[model samples]
Target: MAQTGTAGPASIATGPVTITEVVQSALRDYPQIHVSQEEFNASVANIRLARTAYLPRVDGLAQVNRATRNNIFGTLLPQNTIPSISGPVIGSNNGGSVWGSATGLLVSWQPFDFGLRHANVKAARAAKDKADASVQRSQLEVTTAAADAYLTLIAAKQIEKSAAAAVDNWDVLLRTIHALSSAQLRPGADESRIEAELAMARTQLVYARQADESGRATLVKFLSRTGDINTSLDTGRLLSELPPGGDEEVPFQTADHPVMAEQRANVAQSAAQLRATERSWVPQFNVEGAAYARGSGAEVDGHRLPGANGLAPTVQNYAAGVNITFPFMDFASIHAREAAQAATLRANQANEQLADKALQEQFAKAQAALRAAREVAANTPIEVKSAHMAFDQAKARYQAGLVPIDDLAQAQRLVVQAEIDDSIARLNVWRALLQFDAARGNIQPFLQAVNK
Candidate 1:
């Protein structure tokens, strides 16, 4: 529920973008999200396939062939491609070739399977549900990752800015010390010390810039973008957004979480599979019907029929019957049932373990982290303000020859450290809130809170 910013016409906008926009872009283009969506679609197809067992299977058949109308006492290979003569077996060999055609339609319906088909369909549905949960889980993961990268980039930028500011301040101090040393009011050693401090500040700025660049690269990767990209993030607004109350705990239901839902669905699917395997021993009832007409090239008494007449339907037949099959000695079925039962038990145990242990530990850790981050964020601004005042007083005193260069340098370092700490503290609170939401298997609530 992070606030969505209006995007410009460009592929990569130049202005500040909100956290919500980055997450939206990632959700839209990330490969993992697309892959999970396709998997869910495949699961839907599987469900359809399983339901097809409840419907009748109808097939159409037609054949035309030309062969010598001869039946001998010798054996013949049984193959559809190798046409055979349709005539009564005879002691003498007399044959003639003619064309013949046959056509038929067959329907087979498993009218009942004693709940076996139903169980299979139910299992398929459960699998589909699990796949749906996987899609949600994938989205949550991608969103969380994108948000994290974005926050890290923001923190890096702040660090770079603070470093640059420190460099500028030290440069000014170096110039002041140089002028004082030229006038012999401050020692040359003080000027040299300030110069060294300035050099160190510049080096720190370079490192900060490198970190910033690396963070931007990671953010771009999360957004699924290639090549050079420039991101202008709404860092000020994001940092300003505060949590409702430091002591109030966020409400979360583990059972309703996507991870738990997925595991529960897995258990359900396994149970259904076990039920299906158990029902495999039940009697299976099927109804089959077929109607066919065929033309023969030879008479029943081994005489060849005339040319064109053999191509016409000379015989017609139809049959309908009910079949009931009971597996009386199916060792395979027994073993399969046992395996399915074991799998079902394993799935149940996994779900139970996650719900009882993993989820609770994660929730507790997130809560603790959020609380600590909030406390640090709340205290950092005061530290920064005090450090800034001290640095200003130290600089004024050093220029008046009332304080040593070491004291002044220490004050400057304190200011820079305080600024860095303040920036990190603010971002850490956001990161902790994100972790808290992720532990609950969703980020929507966190986004809503932050955006508000």
Candidate 2:
């Protein structure tokens, strides 16, 4: 795990920030992290709602109306397109208007549904787990990105440092050749050649500086800051040696890795959903108690009630019953839903398997690349040492009038290349380590190793 950094990346201090600090800061406020967190919170709310199904529900209603009262005997189909009225047949029709009002409350509780409510709650919990895994995956992705940006800036700075050194060396050689030519010892061609070499070295320096600037801008973007201002970094220690354990293999543990865990959660969620669907068609057993009142403008003997006589709930009744009902004709739809949910569960399982396979392949590639980078990093110092020795000998010979300036220039080019290679070789290993950690679905372990 990464230690917490400052409050935010926007308020960068003058001192160099560590990679872990930068990444941890971004993790604190990155939009994706918050989005996933909110999703997890929503899933938690859903779990609460699902569990509410296990509790009793109470509803209250109150209404007042003035409408014409009439009587009829024929039955009408059960539907809501038209209003419903309840009264006995009067054997005669009349139209009269009066006030009516009523108020009531009903409480219904499902003593049990076998296990449907429990299965639904279980599915909600599984969904919450999936969302949590998604949050972890988002965090890991952000960490990987920050590591890439920071390392890119460091590598660019390394190249820029080497290019600047080459320019300085070439400029000094040019001045020496000019002085020697003026003293009538070296040829004028030596002065011209050294000048051209210095120009090329300066050009290389310009490109390296540009790269460094671009990389710094990217780093700034990742730091959640808004500007192209060149950010200063303390990369000296990072360039001095390979990170610990860069050459060795880390255990390719993936069961708890965020990617695998997220996929596994997906499978679990699907399985829970399937279970919920399977338990859905069971008999619905509910215990219901209702206390209600009725108000009617028409009397039972076909006479209109007096003014305001039915305006309030003057007649009330209480009823309670244990009702057991089943959707006898719902077999087809329930079967279809069950089949679809089962298929979804199977697909999620397959997806989990695929994620596992992909992770394994990616880990293998990362290991191979790390091995190659470590080997190159191990050998670049020798190349730098040999090139520097050759350049020194060539310079001595050129000054002693035993060799041409071209030979010394060639040796200088080799030394410059060797120096650049040496720095880049180490950075390459760091990048490889970054990939290794990314493939492992987390970067904290690598950050801890590097920072240590």
Candidate 3:
């Protein structure tokens, strides 16, 4: 039978809460989970930004300038530090100032980019997918951690209960020994031994309470709570009930894991970037159109215009042209393409080598731990039963003056240890199950089973 004890302040919740509820609460309220959600939103925005490249760019322009209509012929240095002459010396002089106004509507559209824009869009989408995987991964990690902390707190509380029960049992034995010693039926040495045992049991209870407090604190931290609030776990259900489907072997696949999915997305993104870089060497074609009306004081044939005409629309121009740019002599494009190719190769290698190896190792370890915990959980009930029987027999013998105080104390200690071990064994099985789900890169299925 399991004993119960109060280790801290009263819990705020009215009834016992399930592990699934705790995990859900953490996922909903935890700051770390919110951060991942925001990052996913940012990644979505980045995809929209990349898609903007597919649309035509339109710009509005208006400018007004006042300058002297002067002409000069001289060798002027390009540097800003050197000044140049401005008055006309080779042509007829038009030495007057005028205000010129210009307005235009310009549109530039990349009619063909040789798949460069498409690759950029694809890469951005891949990045968004990777961010989505990251959000899932974050949820899994936080949920698993919260579940572990809850189990630890539950185990610690069970230990504290057992310790408190042991202390109570020792106190009863001490009273009995004291009464017998007073009546000369038991030796004074027996009374002293019982007192020592009672003190040790009390000390153990103190340590157990400390452990419970520490475990509760960790659980509260996982829940992101402020201050030191007491928690009450559903101690009635210390062991996890198996799902209706029973404990069948769960299939493990590395490719389906979130970590692997994120890496795969990264590789895809790298490949898209490499494609974009390779297409950089291809010629880009664009269609540009502009309509503008300008006013000028000087004419092309050395004729001077009036001030009023300078502010009027004296010149109108409309242009429509196709532009083709080929960076044939740019060595930088070649080097950049090579760099992107190397990154793609590295991403592929990491996905195959590092991620695969880590996933395999995690799966193996979780499986082994699950097996060991199951075995221990199955056997601990028998151990507890035998220990209970032994302790009862020893108590009977001690009452009948057939066993010494030392033997009775030893039996009591065994009972206490057995209870603690049984509690811990059951909790370990739950922890092992949690690790198994985590190794698979998602905990939702495991959580659903437990919640059921």
Query: What are the lDDT figures for the candidates, one per model?
Result: 0.81, 0.84, 0.77
Single out the weakest 10-residue window by summed lDDT for candidate 3.
1-10
Identify the runs in model 2 with alpha carbons over 4 angstroms from their true place. Answer: 1-12, 91-95, 172-203, 224-231, 392-410
When 2 and 3 are scored with TM-score, the better candidate is 2
How much lDDT does candidate 2 score?
0.84
**Which has the higher lDDT value, candidate number 1 or candidate number 2?**
2
Candidate 3 clashes between residue pairs 3 or more apart in a chain or in different chains: none
lDDT (tens digit, per residue) of candidate 3 on 280-388: 6778788999998877665665455665656665678899999988888876868777696877668686766799889989998998888888888888889899998
Q: In model 2, which residue pairs have backbone atoms overlapping below 3 Å? A: none
Instruction: Give the per-residue lDDT of model 1 (tens digit) for 1-452.
Output: 11113333335465666788789888877778778788888888899999889899899988877776656666677877865555567654555566778999999998778888889999898888888888887888899999999989988988998899999988988888899999999999998998899999999999999999999888886564332477478875466766665433656678877778778878887887778777777777889999999986766665666757668766899999998888788968687776968776696867667675788788899999989998889899899999999999998999898999999999989998998888788688888889888888878977787677
Worst 10 residues of 2 by lDDT: 1-10
Give the Å error, residue 294, model 3: 1.1
Regions of candidate 3 where Cα sits further than 4 Å from its true position? 1-14, 74-96, 177-197, 221-231, 240-248, 297-309, 333-337, 340-344, 392-407
Model 1 whole-model lDDT (C-alpha atoms): 0.81
Candidate 1 off by > 4 Å: 1-15, 72-86, 183-189, 221-231, 325-330, 333-337, 344-348, 389-407
lDDT of candidate 3 at residue 440, scale 0 to 100: 84
Query: How many Å off is the CA of 389 in candidate 2?
Result: 3.4
Error of 3 at 24 (Å): 1.9
